[model samples]
Target: MKTVQVNIVTPDGPVYEADVEMVSVRAESGELGILAGHVPMVAPLKIGAVRLKHSGSTELVAVSGGFVEVRPEKVTILAQAAETSAKVDVDRAKSAKQRAEEHLNHPNESDVRRAELALKRALNRLNVAGK
Candidate 1:
């Protein structure tokens, strides 16, 4: 089986690095699937789950927002924030989602846009965590 190197980097550190059979992510335009020998490209990522497939195993990572750069043999993700499924705190995400939702529902236009973004990020994390 063919594999490509995938690295996911965050501000804190490198969150994930592996040689995987395939990677799928939600780009700003639409869904993207990358495999070995894919043409070089770049895309803006959205707040959603990143799916990696390798050797009969599948891993899920939640990304708040990011950019993906794909080379012939490598796929690099520079994310604002990312968390693996195991590392995601479901309870915390739930609480955050509730808080953001409340903020969005209120008439505080000053922070409403920020709150909407927070809600999306929280929901993305929860979805990736299987909550």
Candidate 2:
């Protein structure tokens, strides 16, 4: 099977790097799927899960918005924040989700947007973690 090198990175550092058979992610425009020898392009990503397929299995990564750069032989995800399922802290994610929900329920108006984003991120993490 053909494979392409995929690198998921954040300002802090790289989160994942490996050769994958396919990469699926949520872009700002919509969902996208990339395979080896894919056309080169760049797209902004939304806060969601990035699904990596390789070796007949799939791995998941939670991303808090960013951009993906795709090439014929490689793909790079430059995210503001990212965490693999194995790295996600379930407790923390749940706590964040709770806090965000509380803020939304009693929205200060100013914090509404931030809280919404936080809720999305927390949900993404929990989803990726399968919890």
Question: Judged by lDDT against the true structure, how good is candidate 1?
Answer: 0.95
The lDDT values for all models are 0.95, 0.98
Best by TM-score: 2
RMSD of each candidate?
0.8, 0.5
Model 1's TM-score against the true structure? 0.97
Error of 2 at 87 (Å): 0.5
Model 2 ranges off by over 4 Å? none
**lDDT of each residue in 27-83, candidate 2, tens digit only:** 999999999999999999999999999999999999999999999999999999999
Once model 2 is optimally superposed onto the true structure by TM-score, how far is the C-alpha of residue 40 displaced, in angstroms?
0.5
How do the residues 1-91 of candidate 1 rate in per-residue lDDT, one tens digit apiece? 8999999999999999999999999999999999999999999999999999998989999998889999989999999999999999999
